[model samples]
Target: MVWGLTPLFVHQRILPVECWYPFDEKRKYVYETLYFIQILAQGQIGQVFGNGSGVYVVLITLICGQYDILFCSLKNVLYTAEINSGVSAELLRGKQLAVDKEKEELNQYFVSKETFENLDNLDQRLVKRNLRNATKDALNECIRHHQGIVKVCTLLEEFYNPFCLVKSLQMTVQLCFLVFVSVNTTASVLKSLNLAQYLFMTLCELFIFTYLGQVLKVQSLKTADALFRCDWYLLDLDIRKNLLIFLPIAIRPVQMTSAKFSGMDTQRLRAILTQAFSFFTLLQSLT
Candidate 1:
């Protein structure tokens, strides 16, 4: 039930084009940085390991580190949006003030003294009433816009919490697995020679690989979510300014799918599964 509903929520509503950032130089910076960090971490781990198992451990470490970076990037984008919204509100207020001044000035130029006083009093009252109404309307509009952004951010944050919980569980399971592997490896080494050195190596391998795998998984989700959200936001704001960039980013996923799940029914099921599995797999894999 949770699986079926979540995807419908995400794909049909939450995961729309309006939720992403515009694909531009800013986005490119984030993408490049995430890619570079992932690669560099992986490369370093690869160079440090000598055996196949040890190398695998390093690969996992790199993956986990990459995920950390992704989470951080998404967090940054959320913060940026919050800051931008505040700035936009201030700008709107300034524009309203300028408009009000022009309206007052135009009224002053057209009327004579005594007649103007009565007219002025009546006009002043009307202007005040209208200004109050306008201010309330503007405030409401800003609140609505800000509320939508906040809703998405809150949802993303909720999504992240489960990922963290899953990662912790996975780490605990991996540690137990490593201990079992280490005991077996130690027993074999003790029969032939001293076990201290081999035991240390086994422990190190277990820790590094387990940490790496967990981090990588976390980062992948983070990066993908950030990219998705950023593009959605940009597309929502001004499609014309960013449509060319947004369309490619938005449509790329649809293009990548095989024909098997291309039909409406299949696609619907796939989306449901995708959301359910995304939530489930992240948790299960960690466990």
Candidate 2:
């Protein structure tokens, strides 16, 4: 904003933006009128993009947070499996360790630890059953949360598709124009500074979108890893089966698209910059 209004303090008569005016702007009244009009237009455009992008960033951040929370839930589901039973994870781990040590000493233990514990009247089946049930419930909840995340992403893509598409389409041209103007020797120092600021702001806006999208994609892909690390092997057949079924779905990362054409990620920024540079070269060659 400060850059947009820097012309007011400069000695030379320069408008905030370089555009063809309908009337001659040399007259005092005409210059002042157009100056304020340009400032007003710039402010309005800034307000629209600022508010809209702020909301869009907030939503994406929230989804990333949800993914973080879901990961924690999955990793802890095994440790927290105490549904309808007094058996704690600490006790379960202790029992397993003791049985393992005893089997090593005997050197003739062929049966699984749980079976041996059951023979010892430790009620291992009851604990295993409770753990299995708790794991099943937690898996179901995680599946629901995953579904919700996918649904919200789909809705966001639909709602912001047009806005993102327009911004992406114009970014190359905007960058080229800003770069050309800022580097032009004939342009005033203040105007060049303003164009530089605008160029940085535009790049920052695009970075926010692509960076957030990358974060979302990376976090979503980590869900499968979280599931694997949650000790699924210790779970019963049904619970392990559930994890197997979910693994494939979780492996496929979520993505956001602009107008369902371009994927939103850091790569998009690179592609856009490449196109802008190519066009800028052509423009320079033409002149």
Best by TM-score: 2
For all candidates in order, the CA lDDT equals: 0.37, 0.75
Q: How do all models score by TM-score?
A: 0.24, 0.80
Off by over 4 Å in 1: 1-193, 227-287
Expressed as tens digits, the lDDT of each residue in 25-131 for candidate 2 is 86888888888888899899889989989998889888877887777667657655653244654576565566454544331111212132223443454445555
Q: Determine which window of 10 residues in candidate 1 has minimal summed lDDT.
A: 108-117
Cα lDDT tens digits, model 1, 1-287, are 22213324344322111124465422545645544554566556545444544444444444334334333333234333333333344444454355443334222211121111122233333423333334333333433433343354345334333433343344344444434444445443332232344334544543443344333333333333444444334323333233344334323221111122222123333343345445555555665
TM-score, candidate number 2 = 0.80
- Candidate 2 clash pair list: none
Q: Provide the lowest-lDDT 10-residue window in model 2.
A: 107-116
Tell me the deviation in Å of residue 65 in model 1.
6.5
